[model samples]
Target: MKDIARVSLPGLHKSSGGFKSARQVLIIDGRGHLLGRLAAIVAKQVLLGRKVVVVRCEGINISGNFYRNKLKYLAFLRKRMNTNPSRGPYHFRAPSRIFWRTVRGMLPHKTKRGQAALERLKVFDGIPPPYDKRKRMVVPAALKIVRLKPTRKFAFLGRLAHEVGWKYQAVTATLEEKRKEKAKIHYNKKKIIVKLRKQAEKNVESKISKYTDVLKQYGILV
Candidate 1:
């Protein structure tokens, strides 16, 4: 009994498992990335115990016929419990939630490890405050430009989500307003800085002129 107790299982403890092996936080920029490819990479990273944050989910691309993709989404919406429609295979319309669901499908979400991995994953529609300042990692292999040929048609995740009642336009409008406000603040600050600089220069010039006048009064000028 003592020996068995001392023999610890590999993943039985949090400090000794896959979580300990990979504790790094990975911030992924989802812009221009192929949805499936990005989801696959993120799923693997999450399973390896790395905390993954995917930003700009709206910019992620899906490589396929745009119309076909819309049709697919419409078909998916048709799936629901017959008895009570709400009982329900819920479908997410937001790009971030759509990406989250994609990654979740790749993980064994019913199990404890999978749930733990899911817990470490975060998907954001846009780059939020602190994360906006952080350096984001990009997967070259998962980029749409690299994976899809120029001739192939592709649709943005944001566009698709918007079509499916995601209110993406409203969200983007809000973000635009915030950006404009920030720009206005920055411009005001610059104006203040320039005004202060001119004031200081005038002060220096006035002081120099006063000193020159004092020298003239003393008959010290050439």
Candidate 2:
């Protein structure tokens, strides 16, 4: 367990399990490659009664089998519904561990202490400007390397550039321009190819049928 402030016990890795610290705030930004690792770390603290506030949750990863994962996510929400069909208004909300890992990990601790510690966690997608408006500190050297992921492919490349620590907005913008340009060309070519193939097949079929009639007239059954 790495040394972090506000906790009397070492983090999850060192000890057997739960820590009984009072309400401590843990903030994690959810926009980079390290989200899952960070979330797991924060969740452990949360389970120990530390107040956790996650920021930028929408950026979390959904690795592999997106459809199946989505169904699994929906199922979790279904479980959290307030009332069954017979009872009261149905409202479904579930915890997110990318797929199901968060709730599963937290709830399944062997001890009763573990169960009690799992209740204080909270996560969110984005922090409102007001949440940390007072402090505008420079990124730490470790986190200076950390960056936000892009919304689209070009944005991704922009992030890649930023990872190398370059700040090139114009190049990223140009990459998007090129992607769109190439997409247009590809669409046009595909449309033309389909049209040509259909016309060629029609011409061949007509010629073959006309030749078949000629053969029939000569008593060639084919």
Q: Which residue pairs in candidate 1 have backbone atoms (N, alpha carbon, C) closer than 3 angstroms, thus clashing?
A: none
lDDT of 2 by residue, 84-167 (tens): 554633322322323124543645557776655555665542344333332221212113134323442112212322333334
- Each prediction's TM-score versus the true structure: 0.71, 0.37
lDDT of each: 0.82, 0.45
Stretches > 4 Å off in candidate 2: 3-24, 33-39, 74-101, 108-116, 134-222
Model 2: ten consecutive residues of lowest lDDT = 135-144
| Span of ten consecutive residues with least summed lDDT in model 1 | 1-10
RMSD of 1: 14.1
How badly does each model clash, as a count of residue pairs?
0, 3
Clashes of 1: 0
For candidate 1, the lDDT comes to 0.82
Candidate 1 lDDT, 11-95, residue by residue in tens: 4333334445332567788999999988988898778776789988999999888899999999999999999988889999999
* lDDT, candidate 1, at 118: 100
Residue 112 accuracy (lDDT) in model 1: 100
